[model samples]
Target chain A: MGEYILAFFMFRYLRLTLRDTEILSKWDKLLQAGMITSAVLLGVEIIFDSVSQYTTWFSYLLLGYIAYLIYWKAEFSQRKSVFVAVLPFVIVSFLTKITSLTSTEFYQSWEDVYDVAGVFSVIWMIVMLVITNKQNKALAREREKTLQEEKQNKIISQMKADLEVQVVQRTAELTKQKEELQQTLDELKNAQKQLIHSEKMASLGELTAGIAHEIQNPLNFVNNFSEVNKELLEELQEAQTNGDLEAVGDITRDIIENEDKIMHHGKRAEAIVKSMLQHSRTSTGKKEPTDINTLADEYLRLAYHGFRAKDKSFNAIFKTDLAEGLPKISVVAQDIGRVLLNLINNAFQAVKEVEKPEVVVSTRHSAEGIEVSVKDNGPGIPQDIKEKIFQPFFTTKATGKGTGLGLSLSYDIITKGHSGQIAVESKPGEGATFTIKLPKT
Target chain B: MKILVVDDERDIKLLFQQRFRKEIKNGEMDFVFAFSGEEALEFLDQLVHEAVLILSDINMPGMSGLQLLERIKTNYLEPPPVVMMITAYGDAENYAAAQRLGADDFLTKPVDFKALKEKLKTLT
Candidate 1:
């Protein structure tokens, strides 16, 4: 009965192990049939009191077949223990059946042998069950570890994907900010260009009256000479009709001289017009060799004459101390011309109220570079506002009298554009001097 | 009669010589030129009462025509020379100042030489 019970439990274990395998399911069914047959044969011998040798042999054969199936088809870790557990039962049953078949006298001894083998088989089965239980527990712990590793791997991958998304979002935001900054920079550049143009126009407006006077002087000469030439021609005709060859020759010479004067004055007017155009035109930012002395003298006269045109009572004695044979410096002529004009105009304004107003413009070329200075004999700048003069929109003049951009623009032209320096020296109640220094390169 | 023409423009001397060529040739008028008010004063000082008429530009660099006129009216009292002020700025303020300074006449530039010649003829 104990052997039957062990066989039934072993059959159930094999079925559980081979449940999902199609090939192993046949072994499971076979083990179940063997267990049932063994039980029925045992019941027939016990109840009918007649145990046929054939029936006994058949039952032992069925037990051996089930033991082989368990050894062949069970899970690898539990296979050895399960096969060993059923081994003792199969050997004992077979041995008992064989001895009974051999001789009747040996049947009694075989029965004793059978009982001892049964006891040993039961003990072996219990030991194999404990070993199989330990193996299953180890296998279950290994499976749990593998499952935990897979879960950690999935979580790590998810975090990496999230980080990539954050990086992409940050990159897009930076790109948008960069584009906005570039757009703002473009707007500022356009505004700077407009301001430069407007400032040039303002200076041109101040020069209009002076330019008119400059052109008018030459035009007067041209018209007067032409009128004189007409008279000389009439005089020549009279002399010819009178048959006075000497008077005719003299009058013809006079007409020639008058024509020369007209041509000279016409050329002068043309030059003044060209300069006016140059002053008003926008700068092209091209550098050319320029004579600092000539520019200084020209702007000095322009500023003086401009002031005179506006206020006939405003008069100043201007002098020049230009260095002879000074080497020409490369510069943007229009921009430098604007700076000189602004400086000279400032000097004129400084000396407007002085009793004997005097403005001196000087240019010098040294080993270092070229220098242009404008000095005035008037109330000099105070110590406090001297530093603020070059700052944009800083002016001591009345609101409408000065644009305040004159010195600031000049500062930019000399410093930023040309890589030059501009400075001022003044003694209050005495005089002020502005100096511009430019590099040779 | 001798006439003094004062202007800062050096070419005024040539212009005057040519414009009054007939008067000069006929010995009806003699012309002298000074480039500035200072030069005109120096000339008047050297040759007292020699010039009968003075034609001057108002907008000179050092001494203006009005200032010169004032000096002349104050200093040269024995039949002060007739001074005519000329300027490119024909504004009323200059005209009033010249009149107040005892100017004999005022003229705007692009000076009408024909009218000037006729006016000079009456002066002669």
Candidate 2:
């Protein structure tokens, strides 16, 4: 049985290491020889129970085969071969029993070699167990570290996703708030413009009143004397008719020349007073039903004359289209007059620097409202500042030339005072149209 | 009748003389001109009796017509001269102020000559 266990172990070792057909055949032959010898020895021990000396010789042959295996596989694995070499001593007590059967003296002499071989086998087993335990512990530690890295990566990705979501939400909120702030800024700018425009209008009104008062005195003298001279002329003619020829010549000459001076200056003063009244009349506060066509036509001519007084060489082709039979609207005539003046003045300025300057003022009665448009052939407003044009103190004119309150005041007069609408349309190189729409109500 | 015309304009002296030449020639009326309120007051101080009428322009370089009217009403109490206030602006405020200041009449510039003649006739 012991020989069969050794043969089985040798076969397992040969299957693990022997890949060459030549090495495999040698191992197979040695294993067969060991098995046949052990079988024959077992039969001899059964037949001659007293003659076991031959069994000891068979164990020595087995030990010699194990030494040969150790020498042959030494280069393959030194540690495994050393462990296998010690395994042969596990059956050393059976070898001693067979040697005792042969001669007691021979058994006593081999006892020390068996003990040393048994100790080597025990040491090999302990070393193998320690190595295996350490390998297992290292493998478990590596698995745990990999697991921890994977968990940390999952948490980081989750945090990144949450941060992205929060950023998106915050960006949306900021964008909405920014839009609201921008809207408030626009409203504040509009209010500031309105305040500046009213201030300018107040100063302008005062200046106009001063001029009116100053001019009226000279105008009064001209008219008074002109009337008195007319009476004097009639008296002089009546005197001549009664046949007073000697005194008549001097009187007629003096009176006629004086009448001419009176009439000439009288007409000049009248024209100036009329122009001043046309432009500078204070608003009456109460609404009056008025013919819009007459108001527009009168103001257009007055504005033209006013511009002419400033720039003697300025000339423009002015056209008007007054819708006939339009219903008379109730409005504060002087206030509406001021609005018309501002729009017409702006139109004139717009066309001043352009070739073939033309200003067309047109009125139309429509289902929407009373539409008045002041169109000019001039370099139009640019797109960027188009929305800001009506803001107070926003002017394209040279400083000191314009107060920049004309359009702003006009906007207030039309939109707030009259509950009307004013809008502009323009292209960069083309002309511009400013339309004022007053509701019929 | 003698009338005092107060104004700062030098041209007014000629204008009045020319306008009333017929009346002056017929000896029906005479005009004494004062260029300022001070001159008018000085002229009134020298006169034994106040002029039959006084026409003064409201806007003058020195003393205004309203101030002259105040002085005339206070200084000449015996036969209070018919002091008419004339201004270039016929605004309500100036008119009201002149009337409140004891002006006998208020006339806007380019005075209606016929209207002035009638007022003068009635007063005479």
Candidate 3:
């Protein structure tokens, strides 16, 4: 049935209509059925007629019909060699049947000829099956390898993307930190600028105040002396007019005394004004040869007087051990004086609360320079705040009572302004000693 | 009426004394001197507003001119004597504090003699 339908299916196979695949599969099955039928018939004829038990030749005819059917269904018309090969197979199959019925000897004579051909064909078929099976297994392994490689690549791509994201985040964080550090640096610079400006203004204010203080005293003296002179003049004129010569002499003597007093006051005030002006002028870093001992004594006395003048009721003894052979030092006299003043003032204030306060000012020549120290037997600065004393605006004084600029300004004057060294040693309740050293000239 | 000149500096008080010497002797005004604000106040306690005018330096030790002026204004309000606060520096904060404390006038050094005279006239 399939052999008869092979021509119709072949047209459909060429056109590739949707129904063609089913039709072709059905035709192949039909052809396969015919081929099996032919094989069965040939087997039946050989097995039954081996002793010539089947007297009929219809079996061979049946095999021939089956072969023809297989040929028709398989569309082997275009393969003429297949028909040629099958004809010989059919002939041998018939001859084998005839010989099996005749005798075993005749069957053995043809066996050797067909056996090799059969063996070769069988080996070729086995080779084809093995090749097909190996191709399927090899395709499966290759597909599996491709899938595994693709998975690995995907994982790598994900890791790369994640790493890129992390790097970007870290870079952004670093940039932010750098900007913050830069901003902090800017703030510090601004604060430094502000502090220096404030210092300049304070120094200028002090200078102006000092000048005003000095000028006021002398101008007052001039006005007072002139008035006194006028009074004396008028009194003398009155005595002269009345002819009381004795009164004139008395008034004249008073006038001279007042004049002398006037001169004395004028000179003192002038000295103060000039000193203030010199203080405000520019100073270079070059050290001048100065009598360190004299400067020390003057500043110590000035410090004592400054405190004594403020609180007259307090009587505190001051001991001085000024060295006699101390050599002059190279320093800025004014700057060193400021440091001495700061140290002395601190000493005095520290001892102000003590029952029996004594300040010891000692001078000696050191290997490095002339060493001068102001020591006080009073409460000392705390260890924690010792370093902070040199910091600007760090003060222990009550507001408005002290400007807190004293020690900081002194530190700058001695270290930077005079090229000298100042140090402090203190113990709580025992006392503090501030030592200053200037290089010997 | 007598006038009191209070200051720490001897030169300042003497200066005022010299400038007004003629008037003081002519029975126009008698002068008392106090070297400090404390001394001036002590004198005030004794004399009880004897001075119709008080010339004071603002920066003296013990008691400032403003403090003394406040005391006088509060304790002795009736016929409150005129107080002319004299300051070496014309510090605005101090001047403002003085004025707020009822200072009669504020003067900056070096004192203008003519201005002093005018202030004296107003006080008298």
Pairs in steric clash, model 1: none
lDDT of 1 by residue, A257-286 (tens): 888888988987786676677878887788
| Global local distance difference test of model 3 | 0.66
Show model 3 residue runs off by greater than 4 Å: A1-205, A227-242, A277-332, A340-382, A388-441, B49-52, B113-124
Fnat of all models, as shown: 0.52, 0.24, 0.36
Docking band of candidate 3: incorrect
Worst 10 residues of 2 chain A by lDDT: A75-84
Model 2's alpha-carbon lDDT is 0.70
* iRMSD, model 1, in Å: 1.0
Model number with the top lDDT: 1
Determine the C-alpha RMSD for candidate 1 after optimal superposition of all C-alphas: 6.8
* DockQ of all predictions against the true structure, Cα-based: 0.59, 0.10, 0.17
**How close is chain A of candidate 3 to the true chain A, as a TM-score?**
0.47
Query: What is candidate 2's DockQ?
Result: 0.10
Q: Evaluated with DockQ, which candidate comes out highest?
A: 1
Q: How many angstroms is the interface RMSD of candidate 2? A: 12.8
Better of 1 and 2 by DockQ: 1
